[model samples]
Target: MVDVFLEFMLGPMRAIGDYYFEHQMLFNAIVIGGALYKLASGKKRHEREAENCN
Candidate 1:
């Protein structure tokens, strides 16, 4: 079941994955940057609530 699926899916996926893996720096940079941006922006909502106490 899984083997059949992988065999079919992985063919095309591997081609794209190969490109992604070859250029992993771009993927990693985007993921890390997006995570950092999400973390920073998430803090603003909490900070806004805190300021509302004033």
Candidate 2:
């Protein structure tokens, strides 16, 4: 049933939400660090590709 499927999906999501609520600062730091890391790596990759094209 749809209820069963929703419970299965939402159960883990609820746990994650609870954890984030309890550890808001840690979670925010992790998210921001991950975004920065991706941005830095993407910039380096673009620079390398540009150098190769030239």
Candidate 3:
């Protein structure tokens, strides 16, 4: 499912992130920030749809 796909994608991505995180904190911050942004955006969209139904 989606989890499996994310795992596949993030596995290598995490390795790359870790590799770069050692040399550059800003890159790590950006990666983490992007993931947080996506999570928040998805949550906000779901909440908006729920509010519309109510």
Question: Model 2 off-target regions past 4 Å?
Answer: 1-16
Candidate that scores best on TM-score: 1
Model 1 is weakest, by summed lDDT over 10 consecutive residues, at 9-18
lDDT (C-alpha, whole model) for all candidates: 0.87, 0.88, 0.84
For model 1, how does the per-residue alpha-carbon lDDT over 1-54 read when each residue is reduced to its tens digit? 975776687876767766887999999999999999999999998999899999
Write the residue-wise lDDT of candidate 3 on 1-54 in tens digits: 976776788986776656775878777788899999999999999999999999
How much does candidate 1 score in TM-score? 0.72
Specify the poorest-scoring 10-residue window by lDDT in model 2: 11-20
C-alpha positional error of residue 24 in candidate 3 after TM-score superposition, expressed in Å: 2.6
Q: What is the lDDT of candidate 2?
A: 0.88
Stretches > 4 Å off in candidate 1: 1-9
Better of 1 and 3 by TM-score: 1
Error of 3 at 19 (Å): 9.8
* TM-score for each predicted model, relative to the true structure: 0.72, 0.65, 0.52
Tens-digit per-residue lDDT, 1-54, candidate 2: 976776778976777766778999998999999999999999999999999999
